[model samples]
Target: MRLMGLDYGDKTIGVAISDELGWTAQGVETIRRTNRKADMKRLGELIREHQVEEIVVGLPKNMNGTIGPRGELSMEFAEQLQNTFKLPVHLWDERLTSIAAERTLLEADVSRKKRKQVIDKMAAMLILQGYMDSKKRR
Candidate 1:
């Protein structure tokens, strides 16, 4: 079953989708969050379009592994997603995914403007790919 990955932020949500075989994750669009209802509507559309069976949401934990306010927000979002879509939602620890994504873009010599546009999407892909890789190891 295909899985959807999300890196939820205050202003936007980065989206990624797993391949049909659930072997790889690809970066999708970044949704600008207008409101909860609108965000849910857009997510529902993407879910249906991609035939997503599950969702993996990045949970931003502190370096000390503590769930701070942002982490709480992610948990709430995950709960909403599960209730709305009736699909399993998994929270994966996403401590430094964004930093790693930025470093990757820098290594590739991506322009700052371009990097800002796609950083979240790249982070989402990394989150989903990490989850998939962990599953494979089990």
Candidate 2:
């Protein structure tokens, strides 16, 4: 089944999609945060377009494994996603995914401005990649 990954932020949402075979993930687009209804509507459209059967949302956990404010927000988003899209939403620990993405972009010599434009998407890819790798290990 195809899976969609999300990195939810206060002002934007990073999106990613797994391959048809669910073996790899590719960065999609960053959705600008508007309102909950609008955001879910856009996500629903993407879900239909990608034929997404499941969603894996990045759950921002503190380094010590406690659920912080960001983690709570992510859980709320996951709940809304489940209710709005009627699909299974898996919350994956996303500690350091953004940091990892930033490091990768820096190593790639991505321009600062370009990195700013795509950082969220890259973070989403990192989240999804971790989930995919874990699945493969199992």
Candidate 3:
């Protein structure tokens, strides 16, 4: 079954999709946040287009492993997605995934402007790949 991954942020939501075999994920696009209706609409379109069967949303937690406001928001978003799409949604611990993505961009010498544009998308890929890797180990 195909899966979709998301890094939900304040301004944008990064999207990634798994391969048919569910082994790898690739960055798809970044959806700029507008409003709830609009955001869900776009996500739904991508879901349909990609024929996604499941969703994995990154859940940002504090260093102490406590769920903070951001984590709460991610949980709510995941619930909404599950309700709206009627697909299973899983929240993957996403602490520092963004930081890792930033470091990777810096190592690649990506320009600041470009890095800002794609950081979320890259993070989503990391989150999805991590989840898929965990599943593989099982």
Provide TM-scores for the models.
0.98, 0.97, 0.98
Q: What is the lDDT of candidate 1?
A: 0.97
lDDT of each: 0.97, 0.93, 0.96
Model 1 TM-score relative to the real fold: 0.98
Kindly provide the TM-score of model 3 when superposed on the true structure, using C-alpha atoms: 0.98
Candidate 3, residues 17-116: lDDT per residue as tens digits? 9999999999999999999999999999999999999999999999999999999999999999999999999999999999999999999999999999
Worst 10 residues of 2 by lDDT: 124-133
lDDT for position 48 in model 3: 96
lDDT of 1 by residue, 26-120 (tens): 99989999999999999999999999999999999999999999999999999999999999999999999999999999999999999989998
The number of residue pairs in model 3 that clash at the backbone is 0
* Model 3 superposed RMSD (Cα): 0.6
Model 1 regions more than 4 Å off: none
C-alpha lDDT (0 to 100) for residue 85 of candidate 3: 94
Q: Write the per-residue lDDT of candidate 2 for residues 66-127, one digit (tens) a residue.
A: 99988999999999899888999999999999998999999999999999889999898889
